[model samples]
Target: MKGETEGRFHTPDVSSITPGPRRATLRTADGVRIEAVHDPCAKGPADTAIVVAHGFTGAATKPAVRRAAGVFAQYAAVITFSFRGHGKSGGRSTVGDREVLDLAAAVEWARSLGYERVVTVGFSMGGSVVLRHAATHRGSGRGRTEAVAAVSAPARWYYRGTPAMRRVHWLVTRRTGRLVSRLGFATRIHTKDWDPVPLSPVEAVPLIAPTPLLIVHGDRDPYFPVDHPLMLAAAGPAQLWLEEGMGHAENAAGDALLGRIGDWLIAARPAA
Candidate 1:
């Protein structure tokens, strides 16, 4: 990263220099145009693959996201994309409901590139999306996800315990808040509520059984306390990790932690 100056380009580092990703526009099953980027593994065509799902108010080009992608790229091929209503994608966000389609689209793209084992790693809202996506498309679709991991995700919807979550509710529900989010956060989420509310992460995690699940959380997270990941852990046979001082999302994820995530993905792969 560069100085505190705005609009200054970051000096590239060898550790963070991911091979040029082939950018493409992927159409979701619901006909949304999702902007996706595929970064082939530095090690060439390996059977294993990793699909990265970003959190709310996240985009593919963000430094944290790009750093994670670069780290993961060292082990397996990586695919990162912007969900609908965020970044360069089309259509409005239904929060996590319709967002599952975005992840499915990315997973399908990975399979299209001939990756046999696709392991999905998601953060926050993206964590919820991946859990639902794996359950909804379980044992189906061309690139049916083989393994799943959720980090800093809520167990249920409409949680407003923390001030951060309460503010998040405001951003997703109020018109004025949406405008603020558009102008300030650069996130274009719909103001409308979920029509026929989709299943929550707790509900979806159970269905992810037999398909290895990893649930990672931070004890110091402000938006959600320990209960969220614990409730999710109780629902199924998931490998749980409770970090000491981490806060929220990818921004809190350090290089060492990211390396462990990459190791988890590599370990999650079923023997070919």
Candidate 2:
């Protein structure tokens, strides 16, 4: 980071003698084209790679996601990708259901890059996906995650507890709301509801035991509320953080918080 004159502001210069964000298009097991990027660690080559799963309506190229990636890159290499139906990825968003496949692909890609250990960190809807993904692909060497962190995630499905959630439900359920979501948020939500209703985050958390789970939630979040994190924490043997004034996901995650999360990831160790 380069400071401006007279302490006005600092401009981040990620362009170094080393390579920058390596862009790629990954294909999920379900055949979704996931737009992804790899930001090498600022220090140098790293054995650990952090796979970032963004929230609903977030893209790998989005400023918020990129900022979080940059912060994490300080500690380890970072892999950021847009989920299906968001940004440049192909396919409709099943919300969190099939997004697990997208994450699996991203993790596999990270492994192919030769990173010895891979950690997943997600925000909001992405948080839910990481929980389910860790459970769904447990013990699978292909896309196995060494550790997991979910921030501002919902515990169950069809939660209409808050106005923000109600609006989210409307966007995914109604026709006109989908149009607005596509036009305004650039997110293409699927029209159909979950067929069998996959396992909830609380249910998934129990399966992720011994996998180093970390649940982070904000007390003041308008969406989901504190009960969500409480539910997730109660469902498994994991570490939990109840942030005092933090609001939502990536947008609300400042550099300081991200740095702490990075530190946690560095210190996290999975059971053998």
Give me the candidate number with maximum TM-score.
2
- After superposition, candidate 1 runs with Cα above 4 Å error: 1-19, 269-272
Each candidate's lDDT (Cα)? 0.83, 0.89
For model 1, what is the error of residue 149's alpha carbon versus the real structure, in angstroms, after optimal superposition? 0.8
- Candidate 2 lDDT: 0.89
> Candidate 1 — worst ten consecutive residues by lDDT sum?
1-10
List the candidates' TM-scores in order.
0.90, 0.92
Clashing pairs in 2: none
Any runs in candidate 2 off by more than 4 Å, and if so which? 1-18
Model 1 alpha-carbon miss at residue 166, Å: 1.0
